[model samples]
Target chain A: MADEHVEADNAEAIIARIEHKSRKIESLLKQYRPVEALKTALEGSPPNTRDERCKSANWIMVHRAIMAIKDVDGMFSSLDPEYYDILMKYLYRGLSTGDRPTCDQCLRIHEKLTERAGLGCILRSLSDTVNTV
Target chain B: MAAVEVHRFAQCITCHAWSPDRSMLAFCPNNNEVHIYTLMQSKWEKLHVLQKHDQIISGIDWSARSNKIVTSSHDRNSYVWNLEGSEWVPTLVILRLNRAALCVQWSPKENKFAVGSGAKTVCICYYEQENNWWVSKLIRKRHDSSVTSVAWHPNNILLATASTDGKCRIFSTYIKVVDAKESKTVSSSDAKFGELILQLDLSSSWAFGVRWSPSGNTLAYVGHNSMIYFVDEVGPSPLAQNVAFRDLPLRDVLFLSERLVVGVGFDCNPMVFAADERGIWSFIRFLGERRITSSGPKYGSQLSGAFRTLYGQPKHGLSNDTNDHSRPQGTVHENCINCIVPLGTSGSSKVMRFSTSGLDGKVVVWDLENQADLSEYF
Candidate 1:
């Protein structure tokens, strides 16, 4: 019985560690700067080559970070208000500039931000657009 | 090539092909009763309805792979009936619905199914090992208002949905796997689909049904303008093509083949408008069936051709007739062409036509071969 409890505790510890790491990765991705992380995914990680695999592992680390946000963030609201501030900033940037990037590019930035900033009010606003709320 | 004029025949107000291999036809004369006729032992045999639905059966789908027929009602539940022990048994009842159901369809492979109601969600039911269907995944809060119809992609990996809110959504079934994991915490299942995917704006016009082609290359939708729109993945985005009836409007549209499309509307004078050499929608005058769709009234070519000659109306009725013979040439029954199916390859083979119901609420089978009456039901 004690051993089983210990096993459960270890599992909890692993999950907590993953969550902590996810937080760090979420903060980095929220920057959505596309400088360090995306570069690592494209260049650092070549799944085929040994050298590439090491780099690719780094890229996967970032993906794991993003995928982790997907798992833990579901407990509360899908939209995090803290994330909304970042989204609005991006939306504001796009509207202000005639030079707009592709929506797909915008989506990556938005998703990363959504992961970092869980904004309740802004999520509600966005959700209301489709009468889905 | 072979044309038969329909004479006295029972026009099916509604019909469902029970099994795909040997499709059985069922028609509802009233709200609760179903008249069944099957082709068994190489002959047509009318089967007695073993059961009854207390309310109106708005939509019916027969599993083409199995002897199962699914029927939906306004009472907010869908019943799956299976042929067992020489009798139909209620195998499954999906009662999770809190609203009225509009349509039900079985997946092409027969393993999964979709149900849509006035509710904002659509439940994709997967048959479990216990022989019961479970709400495996829910595409929750899908519509602004109500979802009228849902269709599974032929591959079953994608879902196409239409709603009364005038928006159609295409969702990847992959997201359900994501949401299913979250369902462990029921209180927090805001649903990954809660996020916007692809949204089609139909203005205030309600989108009633959506279907993807068997090849998954094209999508066709039926909307309020009595309209049909086709979209294919090309160029940078999907291009919408307007096919069939520029003005007359349509009740529904079905894709039977790549080039052949079928459409029917609330208008009584049911017309099949096949595209001409230029692929422009052209109305068929029902100058008699080129063949028979089933066994039905033979609307003889003599009357139709005579009617055409006496009126000297154009075969392709495209515009208003200021000519003297153009006056009503005569009014055909508006409700008679309730449901139509093209018999041959393109689904527009013009060989024989099958109809559901309109006037008498009977399953009328037409034999377009002899241009004479074939069979009728009370």
Candidate 2:
């Protein structure tokens, strides 16, 4: 019983942390600070934190941050290349776990990034993943 | 302090316009209808709904003098709304363009209006008193791509049009039939009605926003390449200078004065640019750059936030743990600013305030004096 209580406490703490970070990210998005929001989201726990919920809040932040960038090419130029790696991870995880709308957002980011940077970024990312594996 | 009011309409505001008294506003919520709202008891109340278009309403302009509203839609139609006995009457103008009408603007004189369309031509419409209807004359043979923005010179005779073809052209819109007045202020030997007087190739990317100075001698426009260019009417042909900014593509621009301009776009913050005496334009700084930070939360608010976070309460329409709800943005606008309209009791060139509406469904009014004072230090 005591162990279960401790686990619940730990879970609550984790959730509170996630909520705090997610809130920060959402405000960044609403403020049209997508680059900053992306950085904050990547620093904390996995954005797909609440799987049981209808839609995980972190995924929504990721989706909206992507939407805030009106020009994907401009975003690519503004952000560091490594952020794209984090975005790709979000894309894969979101596609596998997110809802239809979230998945659609992920796909759009993928399409736009690919359209902007073309096949070079994708091919390079694929090769990098293969080498690491 | 500059008066700043925030209206949360909760839908994408495709476009917005203000009435003559500035007490009423008409905006399209990414729909076919335009909703007119009036300020009552310091709150906005819906006064009327002007509905007729079958597609998305793309642009709206309110003529303060004439007290008329002009709206354009993707359905390739334009309507003029005149309020008569509390009823808004809509008159369809013979636009004659086959493609979608993207933007519409009432000329400074209120006697004419210009409509930019996806058909690569701008329709200059004027009232025909004989038939008691509106007729349009096409300004063709210049823009090879869709006309995105059109601005009438302060003189009301010259029209400046920006297009997706990466060209900004100035045309003489002097309709001899409707405009019987002599062109005493702005006229050239070759500046005839519907004549393409000058064209400036600013960028290879799509040109989005264009504006003419109060003096009608200088023109400024923003391009998709994240650049703003200036063109001075140096004799028959103009000399153009451009400066690229490290930001997103500016969606709209408005001249605060002949030397200063404010641009807004996906950045959600208005940026100010200035032109030196040498006619060289350069980036000054961003206005309204301050943002709200969540660093210093009071103990009571944090406790309540914790409970709300634990129970998953919807804050600002954002549900669950997916998005932030209650946290306010630092900037005035929360999304891409689609339009900027100069506001003041005086003339357009001397507007002391300006209003901007964006996709985030927030309308924000900014004071020019405050912004100008702020930009001086930067």
Candidate 3:
């Protein structure tokens, strides 16, 4: 059907967009700019796409960007407060993976982010059921 | 700093209300009876016991003008009490609810009252002189879950409800016979009773408490997720903002003025939030002392503190240690707070004093007149 064709086209376009963003985040990480990589990964995150494939692909890029950062406090200092809620969502997503290193890193960032932002960040991330990572 | 006066009345208090003159207190002591107490020569003396509810009383409110007391209970009923010459007489209300009545409040005019129930409906009750009893009109088929709290607007025609469905809704309760058409200040004068005005879906979790500002221009409510939401311009295009806090979720909220709000719940402390000149609401500070952290003492002192706790001398010897964590020390209320009521004249816009009751069965009055830090808020 024509509807099926449109759906397929949309999914393909989202996948291509994810790949392009991942490459840009990777190049930023390569240049030893983890903060920029993080900002890039978090931009337009929890993307408007409902496709599981697109979401997983975007998460992989975000996880890579988060893990690349060496100085957590230094990176958080320069980060904007507007990204706090989005970053918190991704950190929760990272913890859900059950991967040991990913959870450890996410917890470290979560602790610092909570200290910086206060309790509202956690409540927003958990209660905002519409915007899942 | 605010002056605090603590009164321990029971082992647990479900809800409380103050008499019109502020000389007596009526509170449900986590049971079926309502206890009235008065301060006599610096001691709280039990004045009367009104035992009528078959189950635990859930809500209580004393009308400042009419000097009547209304109470709802888990027994699926409500009653209006009249003080007749030293004896309190109870008149049963026709709520007709199949489930428990969770909360109740009198409208500003004291001619009617609204009750929230587990039946997922709000019963707006008014006195019927012909029938010689109270009657209720139900607002049904709107709430998806149990209604948690109900607040009447200052206009006496608009009612706001908080529900477990994570929605705060406004409805016009303008009864034709009871409310004057010109008194519909917030909505159109011709708006019918039980008309839904607005529904806010800002909270994703159960919303607990809802309150209206003194001028009835703003609405504030708290969620189970430790977030407090403020809604302004309450019409078709109302603006709402949610401010999340780090402490435990609040069970109830009270507006001290147009811009100042105090919330109390699982934190066992009343946290104050105020709006700035731009009307952006933010956490100001804890009206109670800040919570003490456990990282204060070294390891050796911690061991000594533990020993003191084990030897039953924790209060005297290890008063500074965090070992006795079961009960929060230094705070007046030792358990989750359940309700807060203003302590000044009922219709005042700026309240200088308020009282809070908690699950620990303590009622503490906070006087804010001399609080230097809070002067700016007024």
Candidate 4:
């Protein structure tokens, strides 16, 4: 009963954090600052060992920002290398277990990344993940 | 009776064009390279690979008279290919755009071509004998968004452009040196190069394709709003009609005759639109046996379908193929049909057979003489 209480509190905290970040991302998107919105969505928090928060808020926000952004070429080409690792992590996860919309977004990002930075960027992300583990 | 022969490929064919004799086919596999295939001994064989672009090729146009192919790509570059002996030589046309080039087409005369770009401009390119290279002039100032498709008038001077900005525009691309002023009797005499003739607001939706009829007076275009619109300019006042079909957005439109048009897109079937002499355009019928609307669940059941999808369950067991992505079941094209080109003698308004390539990696030839109802024709 005590462990269950702790788990509920943790879930509440995650939800609260997601709500705050989602508001920031949505406001940025409304202001037509998609690049800034994308940055905030992906880099707002440190790398989470638990991907629940990362996949829930950040992933959806990133997808929304991408759909809103006019300069898809610019966004993909100018992404930080570290962000690709996060993207690939979600991409594989989404492909294997994500919902249809999530999987679609992941595939779209993969295509854009491949188009802008070449297959090397995606391959590099995979290798980085393996080396880190 | 529409005789349809479908050929499947390993990769999605983003665009396709046919050679003059209808003996060879050139198509882009949604990649940087364009492949040329020819049928020999009743089997299609890969003949050549035109590799020049560094990005996805969006458009391909084969000039029947000159036997040349012009291709445009997301790399912001367009190349004109000339067949030399057995190999193809690519001459890059200077489009001078920073964004992706979306569509390319050869004019009726084959002396020049046009390239539409996401940079909000269409470039009219012609060969310069002095420099021995192709050069382009910009038609900037009209389009506010990416140009999706372009069609040249049979007269070879008037060019029609469709854009994602919800507008279909006509421009006078009459180059004095290359094109003779034969069309001046029919078109406006005072029209100069880069002059906007007509700018019609199609819809709030992005316009996908445009085509000029053989007579050069009628224009047909499709939009993302699932609408097929036609503008008939033969009368004193131009008449525009919009037919909103209850289906997904159409991607391409081709004029089969003066009064008939075929549009294909996300529905994965070719649908016919016809116009009477009064210029009243209407949706006639679909050309294929695949009835997407009848088989697919109605919008009333869409909420339940969404709920089922949320649980990762297939709605009604029929929508299982939706997750398959490329291979859509029970259709001539497994995905959206992207390009359609007529196959017959040039300048003939009545084409018996036409070819279509789609995102499903299938190239199909639909014979109208066999498939279309002949009661009306007879």
Candidate 5:
């Protein structure tokens, strides 16, 4: 029973962290810093929490941050190579939404990302089952 | 330019190994039988067929010291072949596996071998003089999925395994009977058999090939996600680096020297990765020749031709999508390359030649000593 209490506390901590991260990302977007917002969204992406609500909420925040960007090339130019794999995962998640505009924007970003990061980005995003976005 | 020699052995090859002298070859023709071929009069001639496995042979390893060939198969069995007179005889290894054995490799000392299996266990088998047969000890319950490859450390006591569990693990296979009580190299000499030394979760996808450097200080493995990881300082606080590449995932990897590594797989090419003086590993270049784009008819013409064919205006009744075959063109191997074995003199620290076999039924020998482009990387 005590172990269950500890597990519940852990889950609540994860949910609170997700909300904090999402709000930070939104504030970055409002400050006209899409690149910084993308960096923040991809930092610890597909958050470690297994909670479905937290996952979808994080996804929505990531998607908004991704769609807000006007300069895809400029945003990618400053993006570090370390974030390429996580960004690719979020782009694939966007494509799977079946939302037309989201897919179009994702495709544009995917093409540019692939050109910059190469085929490993696509393979890593698709084959990684442990960290599903 | 590197000298590349290609030979078609069969319709498809699953795995291959070379004799101690590198004179003869043993390969599975994508089937249950293992075929031996010899270079007779400057040509590869069939020598013998070892038909023992009930299912497809998945792995083969030739021990240079003992001159024995060990093969594992999907039939849930393994065989150690020894030559008596001109005929080869097989000794069965009792690998207590409920699922298929995926890969096998003899230890560097040739005293024992390890087999990875679909049963999510690794069997470290050694010869028991009292039993007069090979017996295995299971390393159980650690792996969550099938083990894909097993590589023995140069120290002969440490074993590294790559698995579908998306992790590469280091285990101490120190059997008290076969190994000495005190060792100068490995720090964990007192660890019991099948003790987990370290586990690396660098790859988030299924890990395929795992290999140790000649000095046994570094470990490298490839993931299904087209990334290869190099781990240095195998003790506490190991340093790991992930080098992602721009091609299809590699099935196997080989170390040429302390700093150079060659990887081959579905790309049907061997790519070279090297570490700079700073010890950061990166993709260098492909050993295979670059594919030259054919200046054939444009896609617009092909689309119009397809339209004509749909309208029953067939010209010569040929399908418009003639170029849509699945085989990859303009590479040495038309299909996925499965195994790569170094073709160098045994005990040498540096390798200049290597042989690769693939699903395209071709074995290509590559001599990289004369490659001007690779000299800088070396």
Candidate 6:
């Protein structure tokens, strides 16, 4: 009976962790490519913990960024202005995570990526104007 | 999931295409105009409309590389409209053909196009960097009869031309594949003789539909007869000309995949059949009679009021509107389907089959994968 409660807590923890990280990633993508913002966002995140929780958090962030660019494969590598090694390392993290990070999160991130890429500036400005109205 | 139609058109849609990125759709309503619709703000917005095609538009083929559009018309003219251009552009005028053209198809590479002339000539229009528009090659000795259909291979330099001769032949622009001794690529003009591939004897029956497979290995054809035949291995194999048929009146044969072929016709029957060594009707079901758009033509108003008449404008009748279930159209001639073409890409074809139900035209685009009605022709 005690073991069942612990298992329930573990599931709850996993769900909460995913939800918390997803919201933060979405907010960062609302500003710019979540993948591009990683180095800065993770500047304060632990690098040495290597503990299961710490390593898992970093892996989740990297996974989030990779999901942001998964629609057009090989696009981030060729078009991104960021260092190739960081993005390459992120790909490894996504492969490590079994399931693809949610489609909705990727779409939210892609919408932000389009604005950063400078192809959809007019559309972004129109959206901004509508929100202001 | 709830049952509902996904995509619907605004005007009487005659032709359409999904963009290479699947972000946009190009369509023409045969209204002396062409328009591009993009999925913006979760709805369709007319991106651009160009005043083009002075005469009755025949068909529209989107280029493989970009958003460019090439349209052929019965006005004895063809135009290449650059999607990004501000004004209408007349790309080519093949002065050789005297009558209205039946069909026009762009090479899979989208760099070139082949148009069928009423005079039994197939003219090739290719792009030249100096001119900026595709100019004509005006190849002679095309087909003995008016060209009925044209299809380009998905990944090669091959082109197929089906004509009133009840024959469909293959052509190559850059490299010629002729079976003089055997199938070999030769670079000479003499070697480019569109090797007489497979010929289906539909002289008694009007062959209205023809499509090459996604892999371009086999060809599926449908005609006036209630039969669909698979002409296998069109590329230089001993089985290239072997014709096999599943005897059902098929108005059109859309080759969606290598093995899956779909057809629709007169009996208000919209069916999808698959092929391996033999063709089998995997999904056989009834679709309501064809759907006619308001912009479609009316019979007797144009010429002789007969459906089988040779030379006259195509007609739509009063019985095609299946929208009003109370006044449902009659299913008299269950096998008289004239044409079933999609407004978009024929290869990954999401479009429907079009046919005459009474005087009105009714079109039903089948979801080739699920073998279900995706949309009513409008």
Pick by TM-score: which candidate is best? Answer: 3
Best of the candidates, lDDT = 3
- As a whole number from 0 to 100, the lDDT of residue B51 in candidate 3 is 88
Per-residue lDDT for A15-86 in model 2, tens only?
Answer: 677678778877887788877877776555342223323125555556666556666556666676546545
What C-alpha lDDT, on a 0 to 100 scale, does residue A51 get in candidate 6? Answer: 36
Candidate 6 TM-score to native: 0.53
DockQ of predictions, in order shown:
0.01, 0.02, 0.28, 0.01, 0.39, 0.00
- In Å, residue B56's CA in model 2 sits off its true spot by 0.9
Report the TM-score of candidate 1, chain B only. Answer: 0.67
> Candidate 1 — which residues are off by over 4 angstroms?
A1-133, B1-15, B39-45, B50-52, B131-136, B174-197, B234-236, B243-248, B269-333, B336-355, B359-378
lDDT string, candidate 4, B1-378, tens digits: 363678986468989999899899899988899999999999999999999999999999998878999999999999999999999999988799999999999988888899999999999999889999898999997899999999998878888999988789988897777765364545554579999888887575688889988787789998776678899873346788887655556789988877888898866678888787676887776676534333433443333332442343322445553543333333556457788888867656777788888876889998877553632531
lDDT of 2 by residue, B93-152 (tens): 879989999999999888999999999999999998989999988987778999999999
Model 3 Cα lDDT, one tens digit per residue, A1-133: 9976887788798889889998898888889999999999999888775677778988998999999878988998899988988899899999998999999999899878866665546767887776688
lDDT of 1 by residue, B54-157 (tens): 76565677776575778766677777777778777765466577877667777766666677777787766665656545453567776887887777665554
Model 5 pairs in collision: none
Q: Could you tell me how far off, in angstroms, the CA of residue A117 lies in candidate 5 after the best superposition?
A: 2.5
Model 6 chain A is weakest, by summed lDDT over 10 consecutive residues, at A124-133
Tens digits of per-residue lDDT, candidate 5, B276-306, equal: 9999999887775543213322334433432
Decreasing DockQ order of the candidates? 5, 3, 2, 4, 1, 6
B299, model 1: CA deviation in Å? 25
Model 1 is docked with a DockQ of 0.01
Residue B299 lDDT (model 1):
32
Off by over 4 Å in 3: A1-16, A49-51, B180-187, B291-330
1 versus 5: better TM-score goes to: 5
What's the lDDT for residue A125 in model 1? 31
Which of 3 and 6 is the better model by lDDT? 3
* Candidate 5 per-residue C-alpha lDDT over A5-94 given as tens digits, one digit per residue, 9 for 90 to 100: 886787788678878888998899889999998888777777775667767877888898899989997997788888988889989989
TM-score of chain B of 4: 0.89
Instruction: For candidate 3, write residues B1-378 as lDDT tens digits.
Output: 353688889988999999999999999999999999999999999999998999999999999999999999999999999999999999999798999999999999899999999999999999988989899999999999999999999888889999999999999898877876456464454678888889999987889999999999999999988799999999978999988776567999999988999998876678889999999999888786545322232334323433432342323323555444543344556678889999977556998899999777889999887767777877
